[model samples]
Target: MKLAAPIALALSLAASGPRDAETRAWWATTATLSNDAMEGRDTGSPGYDRAARVVAARFAAAGLTPLGAAGGWFQTVPMAERAVTAADLRVGASPLAFLHDYTVNPVGLPARLDAPLAYRGYCGAAALGDVRGRLVICHATRKPGLPGDADRAAALRAGGAAGMIAIADPGFTVEPPRWPFAYARSVRLATQPAPAGGLPQLTLNADALGALIAGSGQDAARLIADGSAGRPLPAFDPPARLTARFAFAERSLASPNILALLPGTDPALADQAIVLTAHLDGYGRGEPVNGDGLYNGTLDDAAYVALLIRLAERRAGRGFRRPVIFAAVTGEEKGLLGSAWLVAHPPVPLGRIAADINLDQLRPIFPLTLLTVHALDDTTLGDDARAVAAAMGVQVQNDPEPERGLLRRSDHWNFLKAGVPAVNFVFGYRPGTQSERIYRQWYRTGYHKPQDDLAQRIDWKAAADFNRFFFALVARVADQDRRPAWKPGSTLAPK
Candidate 1:
């Protein structure tokens, strides 16, 4: 059976010029892209390349001019590939299980490590008291002095520790979404290389951590509680030595970024472009979760890419002023590589890109009453979003979970870094409501997992409503007399 059978039906429905055709076409496109045949579209994989071809073909079909390399709709980017071949960890006499018990990323370290073990609460400089030769076990947090495990590991390495093991928070009711441990693959832009020096670091789950703290006088629960309560816990030496080893292979390959241009009708605004983007890649094959391995990513951007396609189709006859460039970028799951490459090597003049409206994983699981805007306060784009959303009876909101630091986590950040005003959209929920509970449940189970597929529940009406509002928002941005500019006093404002 053809993967796009449902999309074909949608296209036929759209041929009749019904009011909901756009929404139907959007779902059809999303369904086709998220089908099992796409193999989750992992960046730099054959699956992603295939997905790129489909997007480019759709862009051409929409009457948009191909603005990619050599008049093709693909802006190929060179990427460095790294895959872990083997990894193992042992504390005392117990061997920690991979994936379930612990996961290690040997990105910046040697293949093997062996050292005496010490429990350094939170891996802070003060926590590690002159432990120069011991491998350190610590907690990970977004706290100052030890912002993240990488920062903590760098600090430990500078203090002459052999390596570090970051204990995952035991209080987490749901296992945090993570990439596969033993069979992990990563891709990054070859031009922007990784940092060269840092100590070997591993993140251990609560179960694996229990093995190390077994014989120690210190209690694991007490240590975790202290960290959770923002109280300082004393560091101590563990009752065991640590041994770790991992081997990996590194290579370089190329990925594609799809670009199509809708030329502006007005002569004055034709040179400047409004870039609309969404990544078309996901986790692909990984450690099986709930007997499924493919991360189908129906919501994690197959839907948004479909929205980009629908946007191009909707504006085919409209005489918008500013050119709209729909970019289906790849390698976003792998450090936003495709968008970064696009910003660096733009198909059009770099300075001509006035703004970027990025759409990532947007799930309309509940009512589309609230919309979360990332980088909302950074530019006038937020104001434009508010006006359009209000007209559509949707409330516009700033990122509620700002501590998540979502502003820089998506592809829009690259455009912002290049001095272009940008914003990312997500569906939001009110606190203490059933909608909020549903959203949280989705994060705990479906997010980044194999379950994030078409079988999941979807509020079709909400999806359609958001699509309508986004289309209007894009039109507003494209036709506005003034170009998108950073708000005064915004850190991201163009200097």
Candidate 2:
């Protein structure tokens, strides 16, 4: 739904008694958590453990009961850390550096792989003719009828390819460094572990792709021009065998998912719960940009964690029919590890979770006039969110960029997969507006960078408005007699 009109920018600074106090408390908490001392609050790090203690303390002060294991505020999630110590891809005599020229996703790679290369133009079902036992080199295609990355990967694996190397489409615009961010070191669930010798996958930047074409009897310029013009290029075997090797170690760690409970007032409904969640982890350290190494993650997540704390504070001594669970999960940046663990091994029975309202890296840098609710139409939680947002004078809208598939990108996705209705909130903007400009700019510059620290600008009133709306949304869901459910025909709805 479209907002009736734009909210005046002046309302951004208009502050009153208790609201002003809430805003101040929110900022104060954000500053402390986003401080440099936190070391970006990376999952499985000492800094993250400290952040967990802080969350536990806050939850206690808010009069919430610890619902984690051992009656403590920490749910231990088993995770395995994998970092690429050395990775090299050689085409004939030309060798490519790991991060500078190409990078492999550590999640599905083996310790070493040596195979002949075959180019499957789009990795489409028809194009993947006989890639058995070869390293299939595929290009990312934005074609209308072609399959997506996941589909391509599945097809390649089914065709018995040893592995796949995905090269970016030459037509796509590459910002400055050609490839913006470095490959991430990942942490995944120990229970659902990354396949050690699975079909290995690697990605290459379009700009540095000349390395693959060297000595392969392939004209780099012609191939690039053909791909850029969206013309079909014949899939052929480049005259080179690939010897790719990666050195990495698997380390087990316990990441914390802070869980606290606010018991329901009504005895009957108190058995069920409405889960409120926000991830607390950020990229620990990677290739430095502009000489800074730490990713402070203030805007990305520390803000939302603080918002959860403040909402719990506001709900202190309040009454609701169903219990409320505040879950500050870790390893979200790594791939929703903590939330996956939560669903598999919950503080309460999985059947007892009525719904999930997850807060991730939601930007509040502009006026709080519109909200994009992911999975808004899939379940009744969407109705609850719309009603709450409308009551707060904010228009609720569906995901504008469905191609991004944002609903499955965050922690709530795991809960949804477990049959609990879920919704994720994001600041919305029009197609052509200043809000859109600001949103894109923030993502380009600070989304996961060290620049996301408290030094960056924010709309205080917008943050306060969203916090109030979210708190009310939680109360509304918690107080409802019946549990929220997925709408009819939604894939998320159980049979």
What is the TM-score of each predicted model, taking all chains together?
Answer: 0.93, 0.87
Instruction: State the weakest 10-residue window (summed lDDT) of model 1.
Output: 173-182
Candidate 2 structure quality by residue, lDDT tens digits, 1-495:
011111221122223212587777777777666666677888899988888899999999999999999989999999888888877778777787666567777877877788888887778878788888888877775556666788888899899999888876646432112334545476678777466666788877766656665566777677766765567877877667788778887799988899999888888886679899999888766666677777878877888899889988887888578888999999898888889999998998888888999998588899899999988889988999999999888999988776556788899999988888999999998877998888877876777776787667788778889988888888888888667888888866766
Candidate 2 Cα errors over 4 Å, as ranges:
1-19, 92-95, 113-116, 128-134, 154-162, 169-186, 193-196, 215-231, 239-242
Cand. 2 TM to true fold: 0.87
- Model 1 Cα lDDT, one tens digit per residue, 36-112: 87889988788888888889888887789999999888898998877777767787667877676777664775777
Which residue pairs in model 1 clash with each other? none
Q: Evaluated with TM-score, which candidate comes out highest?
A: 1
Clashes of 2: 0
Q: Cα deviation in Å at residue 393, candidate 1?
A: 1.9
